[model samples]
Target chain A: MASADNVGILGWGAYIPIYRISSDEIARVWGFDDKIPDSIWVEEKAVGAIDEDTVTMSWEASRYALMRSGIDPSEIGAVFVGTESKPYSVKPTATIVAEALGIPPKKLASDLEFACRAASEAIRISIGLVKSQIAKATLVIGADTAQGAPGDLLEFSASSGAAAYIIGNPNQAAAVIVASNSYITDTPDFWRRDGAPYPEHGEIFTGEPAYFHHIVNAVNGLFEEYGFTPKDFDYAVFHQPNGKFPLQVGAKLGFDREKILPGIVTPYVGNTYNGSALLGLAKVLDIAKEDEWILVAPFGSGAGADAYAIRVTDKIEEKRSLAPTVEELIKRKILISYGEYTKMRGKIRKYER
Target chain B: MFKDSVPKYWRLRDVVYRLKYIYCRDCGKSSFPPRSKCPYCGSSNIDHRYSKGNGVVEEYTVMYQSEARYQDYQPIVFGVIRLDEGFRIVAPIVDVDPNSVEEGMRVEATLRRVRVDGSTGLIQYGIKFRPSRR
Candidate 1:
């Protein structure tokens, strides 16, 4: 595997849909007790507008990334969209993104699926592409309008969002990846069968055997491989399935609340499926200072995790402001009722027939 | 609600993504949904000029019972937009109340999904205009 430190991220951007649905509203419909919020550690989740989907959100994010990088789209050698909830099962979402950005036909493009951590896989591939001289620059995006069965527990955190990163050489590097590690297995703790509208989970099985194990094992492996301790990092971001999972996993891995909480947005935006960890990383990049080391661990159900050690550079302070910040998007909220959420989600359209 | 072949849509993408219009230098007329032949002068002498996607509403209408993909956005609104650059084109008007729509409203073109074919068919994305806040 190519070391993350060898490749640098030139730009980064985040997108959280403006619409939000409160957990209390979901509780009202499902008749769950008031403890739901505390239990799930989510107050609300971002919801995409009727016109929005993974592709559109990804476009919004990648455009910002391009703005921050200030690079010509034609110069981008590869484009990758990592999402399980892609608009078409057979078609390539990357092509639409490339075409929208006016990328030249000689570039490479493809969609990646690994439940939630698919975008991390794209990042890994991009590192190799840039490092091996295969590509001058690459675009990797994680976006999803995650679906949960109408009233399932998954609904609590299944949300819409996207994050994009442009990886290039140190000439424009806003941040450097110092180390990287990945752990994966065929553990089916959560999944949606082919053509199914929503995903099904093992419920209790998702927690112990799936998310925690993969994230922990990957982070530990990265630490062991690099001979670094938790205190070596100034901040930490874990795959935020909900607000709670990242916090709980961080605590178990010997990280402080202050270290983990800075990157935790799932409390307000829910889990954006593929975008979860990447968004967390983008938010951290927005505020992190030069020489600061941050740890990132992203887990995907059925199940795997990629652990990264990143070092913020002087370029981050300048490039971060060139594009929209995660905080700015979070502040520009338009709360919606559950009925409105269902309408925007297009649930009513298919149900009426 | 419009659907077409993948090749046609692929070709249209370059036009809609940037609002690229072919300028008929012969008559100095510009049109969108770019034409190979000039609509005014019958001249093939043309240049591709990109629109800023900013324009004003010249005419308007509301549509209900739209296509399957657009059913959720019932009462779809559309209008004729007169571009600042001396051309008129018809497109969807969005981000406004149906009752509030009227003539002479300022609008800006944005990319949006137009329609989808069968349950698992091609998705057509195109330019739609929203009332310009500016």
Candidate 2:
């Protein structure tokens, strides 16, 4: 996982839609018990408005990343968007987001799909690009306006959000990538067929086998390959499908609960799919002190997991406030009832123009 | 008729997405929706430049009733923004309450889904003003 050349994160940004729907509201609409929210460990979830989707959210996040990087948009030689809820099935969301951010044409751009882990793969690819000098900096984004079947359990956690990262030279980075590894298998825990408005999950089947297996393997592999242990790291951020999962996984991996608390964001914002672990990393990056080590693992339900050993640099203290923090974005919210949530999420069909 | 056709939107994407405007070297003025000729000086000696997308709201109105596709965005606050770069553009104000909008509030541009041609059509994204976080 360690490379010859030094590559790291130059800047990072996150976007959570301002609209939110409480677990109680979702429970009421689905005729579920009041204890369901507590049991799931999700209090509320962010929702994209009728006028919002992956592309728009990606742009908002990338724009902030560029601001923090303080580099001209033309310097971005690659832009990759990882999303499940693309507004258009045929058109590439990456080009639209790159164009919106004013990145020039002399760059590589595309949308990657591996469910939630797509963005982590994008980051891995960008590391190669930067390390090889193919691109001075690459923009990697994880964004989704995730969908859940009407009245299904997935509705409680499927939410919308995005997080963007600028991967560049370690000298100018806020955090350097020490090591990384990936573990994947063809196990089908969740999936959405083509043209299906919402996704279908394997209910309880999503646990142990899909999420836990890949994440645990990936993290253990990184530790083995890099000769590092959980105790050596200052913090751990795991892909959070729900609030309880990250904590459970942390304890399973020999990490203290406090070590994972700073990065657990799903309890408040629900599961942002692709944005899940990346958003947690962004939140940790916002507050992590210089010289601290952070371990991150993101899982996607096809399924796969990517683990990284990130070391915060002195540049972090100076660059932390350059853009809106994850906490800032999470705190700025307006709650909506189940009726308004359904309307905004387009659960009820409307007139065709 | 496809008013927001793919080609039509694609052709003017720089203008719509990035607030690209024409700068008249002769008159030292700028105009948005980038025209071939500068409206101020009728000068063809124009160069394209992107706005920082920071501005002040000059005037605004709230539309409670919107077009068919825009029903979900009811009470959209439409505003005339005076950019610091010396150009004015009309855009929708979002992410805030219409009642809280003021005549001289600071605003910044953000890319958002402006419209979709239809269920299977292209999703149009463009700049919309929001209350500045700075």
Candidate 3:
């Protein structure tokens, strides 16, 4: 087996749907004071039309990663789909995506559900696959069409998006996986009861107890264990439920705003749940120079964080031809009305039948 | 659910018989029964579109018994057929001996009544594939 550091990301891709819904409109309908920032912190949110879901979004992101990596689908030895919003309760969303991508049945495939951090977990699992030589390439996808009760803060921010990374041997990698650390706690700040349409979350409790505590702990742990200071990293991205949290956390950690600002995606697209932080990291990698260091920390509602330190490589410049950059996606947005947002979010009517 | 009260189509799905499958024009993919959209391309842009309905058997298995509603038709033959257009479907083969069903054997889709619920229930028709006439 190869050393753990031998495994790294070979390629990365992201997808944020074309639609956007303004926060001011949400504040008007919910009767909140217009002066107050809508709970989401974004002017608008991206939504997936009826046909899109975690499975579809993951497929799109994976397709781009595969194309960018120039790796054949048949060569993928394992596929992990990290999602909270699976299409079916019993069926595995990974199998659906694997089949569509033409991954053979002999490969290891499964779905992971750990609130928002599931995709980061998938990345770790793929790293193990590459290090052990069990597979030459593994595809890790984090995607969600997250839902929140209508009129709740989560509703304004819970959006749809996906991100995928192809993990393989470092010598064959597009970016070197330097170090990773995790901080976990059994906190129930947010949860959805079974058969419930939307998730219920504790308002202020989600911040300090769940998001801030876990992310800060993981980032500090990574720095301490790896013997690197915050300044050693060039780019940092966090699981963004809203724009304010990442900036606030960065300030507390003694990091400047400019270091974190470039990777922030929530202010424009709202919270993508599972895809939030990872998609931002994908955006950063698109423009980062070779050998530049990057720090990624993702937090979930149940209270867990996965922090990775990566170093970009020359291969990223070559692979960029196959996938769309964050700038391209942001520029191509389509505005939608408040009522359309309700319909797209599946809050207005039951159309599954 | 009681065997007698079950719908004819639900009961027919139990018995061994061939049925027709349809493909969509926009995506060029075949599906069993029929679907409103191509699951791969997610295009509602679909047509009832006929199936060339001919393919080769991909795999097969025989069952000793089926559900209570299909108890009358014991010993069922089930298999997945790979169509000529590159889509695969699952169904029961008919009008041929069980031993004769092998992988790569040419088959054609046909309309057949798979099962009848009780004595006075509706006769449900479905599309199933069988040994091709050609």
What lDDT does the true structure give each of the candidates?
Answer: 0.86, 0.90, 0.77
lDDT (tens digit, per residue) of candidate 1 on A1-353 = 33545678888988887789999999899988879887889999999878778878888789789878878887899999999888887889899878877788988999999999999999889988998989999999999999987888788889999999999886678888878999999999998899888888887899989999999999999998888789999999999888888888998999999999889889989999899999999889989999999999988998999998888888887887787789888876778899989988877746323
* Candidate no. 3 TM-score: 0.72
Number of the top candidate by DockQ?
2
Which ranking of candidates, highest TM-score first?
2, 1, 3
User: What lDDT is obtained when candidate 2 is compared to the true structure?
Assistant: 0.90
lDDT by residue for model 3 over A160-238, one digit each (tens)?
8889988986876778887888999999999988888899888789989889899999999888887768888899888
Q: Fnat of candidate 1, please?
A: 0.31
**Residue runs of model 2 more than 4 Å from their true location after superposition:** A1-5, B1-3
Clashing pairs in 2: none
Span of ten consecutive residues with least summed lDDT in model 2 chain A: A1-10
Candidate 3 reaches a DockQ of: 0.03
- Ordered by lDDT, highest first, the candidates read 2, 1, 3
Score chain B of candidate 3 by TM-score: 0.71
What is the alpha-carbon interface RMSD for each candidate? 3.7, 2.0, 16.5
Per-residue alpha-carbon lDDT of model 2 for A151-175, expressed as tens digits?
A: 8888889999999999998998999
DockQ of each: 0.34, 0.67, 0.03
Per-residue lDDT for B1-134 in model 1, tens only? Answer: 33458787777788867678888988998987688888888899998887867899898989987756567777888898999887888888865678988899899765667766656568877678877633
Q: Give me the runs in candidate 1 sitting further than 4 Å from their true place.
A: A1-4, A349-353, B1-4, B23-31, B36-46, B49-69, B77-90, B93-110, B129-134
